[model samples]
Target: MPASTPVAHSKTAALARVLDAIPKGYCRYTQGNVSASKAESLARKFHLRYGIGCTPAQRVTRRKRGMANALLVMYWPEGCQQVEWLMLATDGQGMDGEKLLDIADKPGMAWLGYELVRRPDRGRTAWTWRRPASEMAEHYALIAEFGNKHHTNSLGSLLQRLANQPGFHGVREQSKRLFEEARRRGHAGDLPHLFYVQKVSHGEWLRLG
Candidate 1:
């Protein structure tokens, strides 16, 4: 049969067979030629869609220190340069001692760029991850007022306790003081946003919101 045969086997069936042959627990198993081929195909697809370049190198190096090189295809607007997009994609550990941000600020590149950020590391603590400490304080006050007024409980006390989790003990911590302030000046409405900005877990705050 010719390589382009459409008689006995359909393209969908052939693709399904390939997928089915992929062993269970792939993460534990080492990636083989199958993975590299797939990576190259993805690279080509990304090139076509995003007007970026793809390397035919077919050398998808796997897991350098438990983190693999992810092949990402990005589609930016018209006039976006391919090299600029590549630089943005290859950031941090993939960085090759070059100044990425400075390169991005150059004339042709800056026009084609926007900020890129990774998802917040889930392992970080609330206090550590909270943006703008003052905003967090305001949110603390809001949650506290809501709990005291409607729920007849002050989340401020709970959050205050969390802030002093390792250092302070008992209700004598700063959480108690925060609650006192929230109770003294009352607040309410839109509990989720308050929780999003502070010590409360998104899951719990989302339910209450």
Candidate 2:
């Protein structure tokens, strides 16, 4: 399908199936050829969406990698140069890598994007992933704030701690405190613009705008 065409629900489902069949390993799996064409289409859509030139050679390479990456790198074609999107597989072993397939067709999951997901095994490791850290120090500083708070309760507790800090009368105060905290922790940017402040029974609660 052309890049301009609206993606259909059925097509998305098919893409999900294709993604599901992809084996997560260093060695190539022959079984995936059944969906090679569809997988190639999905890959083209992905690279094209990002303005990556899709030459026949690059196309073949991407097709192989799409069907294969612990760390797949794509260098832009000449005159179409751009920063590469790093496709890092979380696991060197295939066990955790298989979890990536689960991201397919889920709500809030991008078809061609990496995501964070808990493994189904007893350990429940975070098999999915996040975007690469920003090169900008300021942007990375904000990301540092909640980088380790993956659990809902842990995150809520952190927020509650911030809310309970003294001298906070409202959401603005809370947000300002957050900015100050980020800055204190090495955020080099200006006060971040927060768009919302929610009020609770006890006091004003900070909600990211």
* Highest TM-score scorer: 1
Q: Report the number of backbone clashes for model 1.
A: 1
User: Can you give the TM-score per candidate against the true fold?
Assistant: 0.21, 0.19
Cand. 1 TM to true fold: 0.21
lDDT of 1 at 74: 21
Q: Output the worst ten-in-a-row residue range by lDDT, candidate 1.
A: 200-209
lDDT of each: 0.29, 0.33
lDDT of 2 by residue, 1-209 (tens): 22221121222222222223233332221112213224335335434333122333544565565532232222222233222222323222332323343233343233222232334436543232222223223333443555333333433444444443322123334346555655455544344344332322221111211
Span of ten consecutive residues with least summed lDDT in model 2: 200-209
- The lDDT, on a scale of 0 to 1, for candidate 2 is 0.33
lDDT of 1 by residue, 1-209 (tens): 11111110222222222222222111111111123324334345443432123222321232233322222212222332221112122222433332333322322121111211112237641111112345446756576566666653455444543454322122123344554555555533222111212222111000100
- Compared with the true structure, the alpha-carbon lDDT of candidate 1 equals 0.29
